[model samples]
Target: MRGKYIALLVAAVLAAAAAGVGTAYVRQAGRPTAKTVLPTHEDMQSFVQTANDWITERQKTADLSLYMADTQNGWRSDGQNLFHTTDGGKSWDAAAPFYDGGAADFLDATHAFALAKAVHDEEALTGISVYATADSGKNWRHLALSGAPYFSAEGITRGVDGFSMASSSNGLLILAGDPAAGSHESVVFATKDGARSFTKQADSLRMPNGQNTLALADASHAYLFINGSAAPVFMLATTDGGKTWKEQDSGLSPRFTDVVPTYVPVRMAADARVAMLSVQNGTPAAGAKGKTETADARMRDVFYTLSPDGSVAGKLTELLTDLPLDAKSVSMPDAQTIYALSRAGGKPVLYRFQAQGGWKRVESATLPADALQLQFVSLSDGFVLQKDAVFVTTDGGKTWVKRPL
Candidate 1:
């Protein structure tokens, strides 16, 4: 059965590669050099002050306007106060907070929501707060939900894991979990009358061990990747506003964890019709001599699964063969383009794929000493947040510019 599953997985991956579904490459032209357009000291001072003030104010009143990409400065907010830029990280600004009172989500300029968790210390007490902002983060209002689960010290904590909102309406959905109490769950809520009121459609989802991550496609569809006892399991298609869900049998098995037998969904993406999950598995090798020695050394593999129209379409693809893994990150700019950030040969590297095409290296000059945490903002731009400053790249990372924060 394992062999059959593996064969099917390989076939599906090859088919996708052949279809040109994720194969595309761009070449580096010149020696990578940093542009001289570094952020000034005055700009850094202003940015730090703004960010600190935002955090402080949120702690005090929890009221603020969410704004992004003001024409004065080409700043785009990922959430409240988390800003990024395409024109060489020049300036910065603040935006709205998350639904659970953490940070906001900037799907674009106009449609965004925040996730706020009502927790004290490691315990989630009662009430989960969600806020949505229209008008490009100018104003935000509470999303009132009917029978939204109110948490007390006795109830489990619904720590916000991920959230999803639709572009058409103020409808919103949030996924949360309680890791401290060994509870993994998700909830679905929707607001039709602007951000005024929401309706709770489902109870929380309970996976075997816990849920590592959740991704929502829209108001009606979402996916949860659950870490099972020995393997990673996938829950797909939460229709009827996440009240009930169906398992997607992709003929793909997720990577397993030996420490606690838990699985982590490193990356997840979905469109209106399809969803993709990338899972990581770590296991002890067979050749090792003793339990302690063998346990210390392990092998890892990363796999990808696809769901077409909220249903499993095919087997999984072994994107990376057996090797020692450090950290992996994947980003889907659009439905057809995927970017992966991984550490190869002990150095950070970026790879890009257009549907059907195989992975191709994104050539960029060597980063500064101990420069890790490279984040790809888009296909054409990326950044590395370092201790001293944040580095930015505009030309497919071929050239970079530093912006001090």
Candidate 2:
């Protein structure tokens, strides 16, 4: 973003803003271009921005409040970029080019790590690169993982599931595969020197009779959500740093008996509750749309608490069961609150669920189009991810402004 821009690119952003976020004139899909084509500075002029508008109103009353996302939802010429706001969600700014956003673990304002994709060819995902930043986005250090289990992009593009950083110097890096491929394989790596180096922990950690999803409680603790032949939300725990795994009786299997469905990977650290939506007798609403959910897709929002010991807290609370409209996109900000993005009457709608009242529509003036993910740091401030841009809501999902990414 530093060297490509000239005076002419400003005109292009103005034109893009007019045609709207969804219709960017210079949009290209799938990672960078094919390996055969060498990209140029001009090619990035469309997606890359000089910088975002500075936080319009700084809030000095609050002690440094920040919300951030290593946004990787959209098409990008320079891998994934990090966007953050210091004063709640009053405004946001692009922090740095953090590749493989799904694998990003932002420990705080100054420390982060991610598994960078070293594959130039979009066809074969053959290699991986480790990136760590200590002084925020100002600089990054490339780490060594000579024997790291590389990602496989056989056909469908699956990304790094997540990176769990318990502290500045310890973390877990996970890469998952397509769930539709009968059996799922994920590689887990553990690092003690802030990802400066890592040890391959799990190359083929059993997903026996089904697909698997990884839920990390921290660096050494991980929960495996086994779907398909197993019971719904059936899990296995690895407390000894992913060396071995064993099934645990979560004790909530009886609650999800009716959830004849698929699994949605929940990426939260210890003590964080995640809402997993299960489509009863139908495919998962997220990636599977036109498969079998033609009739009413009865969905349920179930919350699970991940313990520090890498086990589901055994308290599975079912909320919003058999709703006509699925919280197709579900996020549990806390144990008591949930935010969901679903289509109502063929248009996207945001709903907030509370223990006090139930699901209620949140009226937002500027939430445009469909959102890919929702990240709410508090009850009031949050970030919504779209394909091309990120929208920030400072007033409890009522209004939003576009942030540069």
Candidate 3:
């Protein structure tokens, strides 16, 4: 009975976010192009200055804050700055120098931590640092990790794939890494004393042979999704503050295509009931054997539910069919609200899903051609990074105005 329920849940979640078949776009040759309206250097400078001023004013009073990483350098640290806004992103401020990975968490209004990797000799794994700030964005303290670490590089550096921060509390931080060189050696680190020190906790969880993706419910609970192996395995709960973990039934087929991790589970209404979504490649079983033709016509399934008591619940919901060919990111602001960003019609589009309304298409504001990363900070606030600039929307993404800096 448990096995049957698990199978059903898996089917439901995967069935939810799939996209339906639609007409592809065709371009006509020799079409006249519209004139580009680029912002001037001075105009951009003034915009950034204004954003900084707005941030300074809001810091005077705000309960919580969300900061977005600049995605111009492919979300790297070289030329980007951490743009943070307190009052629902109406204004912005720059954080101190930090590496550009998708890892950051704010313990409070005046405290935050970011995972960064240092580059030396064209190699990014040499120096891995975690930057912490106690007084909001004023001053930053860098804590470096010795020895080569996986997933420390910014983008596709050839070693590890993704590095993320699961949870942080009481000076203890948990970081998850997917190393390419080491099979069955996905790494997770636990640091005491505010990342000043570190201890390896990868051995606690029995990760599968290939790559593993992880998400945290809070400082104490985390979920890991292992793929690329014969059968997919899941680590549902991690005790000892992410040091050691125990497995739970994922109800997924052994095969999955892509997995994206998120940090929004920490903000769920109940910390004990955490949620993570995965888009599984649903090509028929017969064609799954080949490498070339099997990759084509791959379907996607979006699964969302609660991971509690070593199992998932809350009815696996099927959201879409034949989703975007290059869907990059999906975020769940809450159990009921889900947002997905993908390139459609040669432009980025935002899709919103509510518990009651199903899926609705919404127009996204124009973004710079270079802007690549999109993150939904909250149900009402979203941000996109283009080069050195950050654009934010506070009213549920209807209008995305630029918040320079």
Candidate 4:
């Protein structure tokens, strides 16, 4: 897409006006109004200048530091400092500085948790300190962790591989891989009474273990996608916090001999009935010694599933089959909507997926070429992570607003 193109958030207002007029006509005339007129390509192009002008102004002043956003809040991190905004990206204030490397989960304006690795601890290679802030990012306190992901067998401590929080009282910490052993196993730790305590959910969870991710719909419902090897990818779900889990059958092929499949869980509805997955397939390439093969590859297709609320049983249907080979990311906020980013003809392109509709190209202002990470607070509210900053869209992807850190 070209930066000169105009966006069509105007359609949002048009749709609402049509709905109101249609309702009034039906009530007065005892019949529905005619179908609303669709805007022509010329009409859409008329918006190009307006969008280009806004983008030009933003580019002149963009700081390119904002890293995360939700419906009501935003977060930014420079190399050593972290900042936060609560009034929908109007302004931001510095929160705290992280020395080495860390990850944080901000549930809302008042509650947040951060994990930072110790810089000078030589004996404990993976030593981490947990910090919690309750005064809306103004103050922070160190919280004690009951147990961390340390393994006696390997004699090496493992830092947090992933972190997520559903509420002030519920969270999950995932630890995978070994610095010394190169293992493909994952262990899940759950917290119920805030960060006061943590416990291993069960036995060590075995997965295909390339890159795994967790999606928590709430304190109760969540899904875990483990990118399997040559075997079937594991799609695990939990309904009662992390106490129990069930491996979901994706209804795809049990195994693929021609192409190795990797599954990325995109989104799980709050009801847990609607879910989306991105499937990546690649031919195995011979390793250095020809004794093993690697399946590092790009995405091939996008699929979605729908079942009863909170149940893992569902039917998998392939949605977009004709994506660019360089398509690297997909995010679904709901069952019927998706935003996929990829490269086309050596340039970046973004696509939108809808239920019953295969895929449509989004031709607004161009997104950053390195845009990859996507987070959606709802079907309409979402954020995309670019190389340096976060771009947010409140009306799906029709238009985006930038908040530079």
- In model 4, the number of clashes is 1
In candidate 3, what are the lDDT values of residues 1-405, reduced to their tens digit? 000000000111111121221111101111115543344446434433432332333222111222342221111121235544555444555665553533455444565666566555554345456777767667888877645453434422322222333333432333333444434343556664666666666632334544333444445555554433434333445655666667665544333232221111212334334344333232223434422212212124344355544466643344332322111235555556766665444466677878798888776565433343455646776665554456666777778777544
Cα deviation at 163, candidate 4, in Å, is: 2.7
TM for candidate 4 is 0.63
Candidate 1 C-alpha lDDT tens digits along 1-405: 000000000101100001101111101111115433333446434433432332233223222221222212222322235343433445544454443235344444455565555434553244556666656456767643322353434445455444444443634454454543444565556666644666666656555443333445556655555533223334455655567877665445222223221122323334323333332222223443221221111122333444533555532333441122212234444455555555455466666666687667777775433342344545676665444455666676677677775
| Model 2 lDDT per residue over 84-140, tens place | 445433444565564543345455556655566666576554456777777755687
- The numbered model that scores best in lDDT is 4
RMSD of each: 14.4, 15.9, 14.5, 14.7
Which regions in candidate 1 have their CA more than 4 angstroms from the true location? 1-88, 97-103, 117-125, 144-158, 168-187, 209-211, 227-236, 250-305, 315-318, 321-328, 366-378
Cα misplacement distance, residue 252 of candidate 3 (Å)? 1.8
Cα lDDT listed for each candidate: 0.41, 0.47, 0.42, 0.49
lDDT of 4 at 286: 39
TM-score for each of the candidates: 0.60, 0.59, 0.57, 0.63
**Regions more than 4 Å wrong, model 2:** 1-102, 118-127, 147-162, 174-188, 200-204, 208-213, 226-234, 248-260, 265-270, 282-296, 306-328, 403-405
Candidate 2 vs. true structure, TM-score = 0.59
Write down the RMSD of candidate 1 (Cα, Å). Answer: 14.4
Candidate 3: 10-residue stretch with minimal lDDT: 1-10
> Candidate 3: where is the Cα deviation over 4 Å?
1-94, 98-109, 116-128, 142-182, 186-189, 196-206, 209-213, 226-236, 254-299, 321-328, 343-347, 363-371, 387-389, 403-405
Q: List the residue pairs that clash in candidate 4.
A: 6-48
